[model samples]
Target: MQKIRAVVFDAYGTLFDVYSVTARAEQLFPGKGEALALLWRERQIDYTRIRSMAAPDGAYYKPFWALTVDALRYAAERLQLLLDPALEAQLLKEYACLSAFPENLGALKRLRAAGLPLGILSNGNPQMLDISVKSAGMHGLFDHVLSVDAVRMYKTAPEAYALGPKAFGVPAGEILFVSSNGWDACGATWYGYTTFWINRAGHPAERLDVSPSGTGHDMNDLLEFVRTQGAAV
Candidate 1:
């Protein structure tokens, strides 16, 4: 196991349970929420890439919410689902209050008490991350939340990967970059940190040129990885 000092985590899929929001969407939207949600998150990521690449002169300010709307619109079309004013409003409102995973808060609390520096390196804007953290009641749990918005790029971009260590003022190798997204993990690992892949979906790693240092089924296993590094846990 690598001796990780400051653990830098990827938000969304890593620690935040996005599915909780989608499932609720199903309940609230009465049959269109889940499909809308699947489309929403996918476009959320896709738009980041679009904005980053079309960096048409320091103008990549496609906020996460905008991307959500844009993606939801497109995803609805692709999935052949209808989106009305009421559905759109509900999705956005619910997203603002998405909760943390069942074990996320406890795991983070335990990790912090165990003496690890916890932080969120997310693709979300600072405001968005703040909302989710507070909704999950994890406002003060993280030492800091580093968003790619600060760098004007998404996590897959080189500039995005540099945000965490830059904010933490630590070496890349000292951070444990955890993510459920393969490409995100590849980006973090490629940047030199030890990565822990929260493979909660049982999916394979991205068919890329690199692999993360470790893969676990859930957050508990991630903590175990941290314990092996040094903490008694």
Candidate 2:
């Protein structure tokens, strides 16, 4: 394999714990927190996929922040929870600064020290990505924080994956694309990027024909994978 020149990560479930909002959610909704968090995440991704499928050219694009709010409202309604404006605002605030995974900063620092360019290719809007990176204390770790909003399309779409190589100025094959979502890994693979699936939950792989070049559970494992790939991280 060509030496990995740049590492691009998916933001939500890979580096940041999207479910970290559950604590604030529990404080507000008591027993429905976990369910709401899970369902909300599901619906958020679903909406992105629906939008992309409905308009591959991004004719139906909505910013990720708006989709997130819509998904939360839908989840709450499905659970029969009363999500008034104030409560909804609180949840959205928490989501804006979701917690980083415990192992992320250390691993990213090591990669950066090795002179490897690191970046984020996420569905988040630029403002959302900036705030989350700052909130997680990961402000200077990445060389780029790319958003699909540029193309107005979400991931699993070729346009979204293309941003990484374009931003890094490298061929897709030389950029190591890491994502926690199995489907996302598959998408990156299909896009011709060397992919790693961070299966943090140990979930089964997607049935998609494409598979990631590697798999692991956390940033530490990602560091090790980088080493094995001939990157001196």
For lDDT, the strongest prediction is: 2
Q: Can you give the lDDT of residue 152 in candidate 1? A: 79
Per-residue lDDT tens digits for candidate 1, residues 1-233, read 55677888887877777787687678766787777787778787888888888883438767776777788778777877666889767767677777777888888888888888889988888888888888878888888798877777776777888887887888888888999888888888888988988898999778898999888998999988887778766
lDDT of 1 at 226: 83
CA lDDT, every model vs. true structure = 0.81, 0.92
Q: List per-candidate RMSD values in Å.
A: 1.9, 1.0
Cα deviation at 154, candidate 1, in Å, is: 0.6
Residue-by-residue lDDT tens digits, candidate 2, 1-233: 68999999999988888776988888898998999988998999999999999997899999999999999999999999999999999999999988899888998899999989999999999999999999989998999999999999999899999899999999999999999999999999999998899999999999987789999988888888989989888
Candidate 1: misplaced stretches above 4 Å? 28-33, 56-58
Model 1: per-residue Cα lDDT at residue 88: 66
The residue pairs found clashing in candidate 2 are none
lDDT for model 2, please.
0.92
Cα error, residue 195 of model 1, in Å, equals 0.5
Best by TM-score: 2
CA shift of 197, model 1, Å: 0.5
